[model samples]
Target: MRILQLHVDFVEYLPVKKEIDDAEPLLKNEKELIEDTVVILTSIENGDDETLIEDFVKETLDYLKKIKCNSVLIYPYAHLSSSLEAPKSAFKLMTQLEDALRASTDTIVVRRAPFGWTKELGIKVKGHPLSENSRAIVKKNTERQPGTLVEVVSSKSDAIDNEGSVSSALAAEKDLKSNWYVLTVEGALIPYDGYKFKKSEINLENLFKYEILRKRTVEDQPPHVKLMRKLGLADYEPASDSGNMRFYPKGRLIKSLLEQFVTKKVSQYGGLEVETPIMYDSHHPSMESYFNRFPARQYNIKSDQKDLFLRFAACFGQFLMTKDFQISYKNLPLKLYELTRYSFRREKSGELVGLRRLRAFSMPDCHAFCQDINQAKIEFLKRLDLSVSVMEEIGITPEKDLEMAIRFTKEFYTNNKEFVQNLVSKIGKPVLVEMWDDRFFYFVLKWEFNFLDNSGKASALATDQIDIENGERYGITFIDESGNKKNPIILHNSPSGAIERVIFALLEKSAKMMKEGKTPYLPLWLMNTQVRIIPVRDEFIPKCAELLDQLKTNSIRADIDDREDTLSKKIREAETEWIHYTVIIGEKEVATNSISVRDRLKKSSYSTSIDELVKLIKEPMKGKPDLPINLPEYLSKRPRIAS
Candidate 1:
């Protein structure tokens, strides 16, 4: 988390001095400030006098100390884009700075570019000019001298001892077009240039000592640690990267179910499925405008030469895709749905809870383009119905388990109060509402979906926004049969805020319920392993296998436990994994052609035929269920205000 701000300027001293003054306030009383500034001088690219360069370095150091600033970052910015073969001045300056800083402070951390005798011995150069040439040399050399391209080395010997034997062994490799070698050091092989014999380690520990990485261990672990552990991810450590854990097996199961659910529901409702990129140029009106208001949540990519950012919402992209396409009044309400990944900003480090506030996560995002206010309301109700249906299918009940609503307040409805009122009336509920003050901004009308956690705390699970501002910003328009151009009202909605968050909530809720002597009852569809066939004793193994085969043939998620563990242990493991049902087959059941079923939540067992069990599970899903209306009439009638 440590961030180092370097100051490298040889042209002016006054601005450099001012920059220090500005940066000091940001670090004051926060991080340890180094004591003495170090200055380094080097010969110019054109072989200019070394004495003059040395004089400038000494003067700069003196000036820095006079201003009560310590710790200097020296970089020869002049030589970076030069045509000279080698800038000796830059090298000399670096060496002098390193020595001076070390002498002045015991905790001095020096930063330097990677360099080695061969290109292959240093760190990989991303987008480096000499990378192609270096790669060709390493390829040729490794082919000719196989032993020289060492893949593994003893970490203790190479890093701790800094043995020259390892370097020499790497140097003896065959030469290709370029003079570069790959060295196996500290059990970590790095590519380096042939001109330098050694490359310095990044020294991240020491470098970050004065900044964010200082003073704490357990508290400093990144947010992703718990998430990574939960996902059982071992390939890439979550310590340094920004992305959600894509558990292939579990993710595949969840995604398949969601896709099937959405496809069936959307098709039945006459909605269309759309897909878009995960990242987009930040110049998109939605982003530019959003950043203007909430700069903290926006991320920018300087390397792309365009304002590129990870998309936080999918509606903008979907709107862009449909913008230019000709649409008549007949296409009054076109609903588009997409299950996509998005990223959002979490203000503080502690705000990042497992899957709750990830830098990257996926959601079931949808947008409805409506011709009129009434059409928008119709689409909104349909979306509400779908959200409740999906949640119930996944074992979340509205009355006892979930409470959600369309948010209406002064902040969200200041500009379009009437529109918000219409939405609230149509949805027929306001169980969860956040009254806005004068400070609230953006969107004329917005709906927030919430769920009650085990702690009785309500967490917003999703939102649907009537974005008049964004529609105006993007100029999304539709044409009537009379040729009148009208702005299409945009409904920005997500059924689930994030799949990871929902999963985390579910896990916590289940754990709490189990602790309170309740079973984790999953609806028929959402179970990972819907059914588990457990043999009561070794004698019932054959009958259990036969039942498992039948369940699998019926496309029901089912598994057989034929392990050596006791039946209790097997049942416990199944419950831990959140299996929906545990079917126990014993000698009596085997002989009777029946099975004892243990409901996950009920903690009770009953005898039933296999066919009867299937019928019981499928009974609740006989038809499309209506959205639950649990709100008091007074709350439902509350007027919505404009943003």
Candidate 2:
């Protein structure tokens, strides 16, 4: 926001014809309007926000106080800056500036002329050092200014963000926005070449070369959503609000598998499963405070004259549970976890696309209460590993599929430098860092594992925040060795960030493969039909059924393409569904006790026995829970998700 302050002896301005569509409806009569006032030429820019208005007004009042002036006139002049905001946004800002000026006790009368109109002005200049002064206010660097007053209520998360985007960009890539970090796997912050990452052949690195920035528009659908609809996984439901997606049988099955896997992983990491209310009193002091602290938007509900907000995450739920628990230092690092099926976040309409961004999602929220910062670090590392393992199990290769980002306060960096360095070392990659001078949230440090999608916009898949404030806010305390009440350092973790987004990421990964002339498919365990058994003729139908039963008995998700379609058409349909393996049976195969297998991943066909095929599918799926195929076993019985 740029402001040109002209401490004039007298200024007169008359509004002329509108130059823009959003120009204020004001007419200049035959008589010219004149005023003896100090004129303020304001230019609001793209990045100006709600907090900016408060800060600007405070600064303007200070200038007014210094110059011993109480009357001021605001003039919206776009020529003060080349980078002007949208006309609507600028008009709103000018009104806010005027309102704030009027609210101040220091101002006798404050007024703003009509905005977005050509104006004829005459002014008598006052020649003094303070008479003509220009000020450039940048939202980014405002944090450094001690006197700058920012509205924490409106700009809670915005205060820490680089732009409107929350994710950090890659540090090495200039085109990407990222956080800074000191990564150390070998006990110190090391360079990228110091240790080799366990990079998979995901071939995701080349995506960064394209500089695929975000196109934030509601009409532009993500590529993964199209594929998701095609695969009968999920699609947007018109009955629900935007960002609310309905999962078909296949999509729900995929979501369930991920949910079950993440839940078990959290349990293994010492988290005790807990469930909390879906809605809480909005008037609750603690609830309201925490609402402002967290970055997510909320859905408000009015029931029986009481206002309530839907749960955005499990923070309040788990925290409220801990507040009632009779915990000791021995149970200090108590992990409470929940897999919320319908967690709600009011994401903007333009930001909602497929599962990548959703208003309603299944969030796996885990909070670990530690005795101290040291114990919290230990638990944080454990949750981080759990997140990485879940990703790898779901076929998303770490470092290849996701990037890590860390944000902390200067206090944490100064006091616990080695601890943070140890984290980077374990990950073996440099992470983006967002540093704050003062502590904002409960946690001094927080990290997110980000998934960059096909559209080049990254989403936080797995995230953990070290909260130092919530324990005290909720009165959640543990008995110390001295039997005294002590606030436990809370670790807010979502090991698998959101269930839908994981599916989205997997879809995006497959999309990337297809773009590179490779077959696109979900993981075999998560697919609606892992294997399709096809018969050569009607006589072979019984043989195909026999094979399907055998495969299903071995826990393989198998189906039969029993539609009376041509053999070529059936094979084409199987290929399109991305069925991992296609088995064809005929007189030759039945006599020889062998089946011709078309391997989608290998892009090759070979004859293999039923026993060999089961072994191949089960090996990779070992130890992973499988969801039953939600679609009909026979293709003829199933309806098409996409035309």
How many clashes does each candidate structure show, in the order listed?
Answer: 34, 16
Top-scoring candidate (TM-score): 2
Model 2 spans > 4 angstroms off = 1-220, 292-296
Per-residue alpha-carbon lDDT of model 1 for 160-228, expressed as tens digits? 101111132222121101112122222221223222322232221222221222332333433333333
Model 1 poorest ten-residue lDDT run:
156-165
For each candidate, the alpha-carbon lDDT, in order, equals 0.49, 0.75
Instruction: Candidate 1: list runs displaced more than 4 Å.
Output: 1-243, 246-248, 283-290, 296-307, 342-348, 404-440, 454-457, 536-540, 620-643
lDDT of 2 by residue, 441-500 (tens): 566888887776666676788888988888899999899999999999998888878898
- Per-residue error for 563 in candidate 2, Å, reads 0.8
Query: In angstroms, how far off is 128's CA in candidate 1?
Result: 27
Model 1: residue 591 alpha-carbon error in angstroms? 2.6
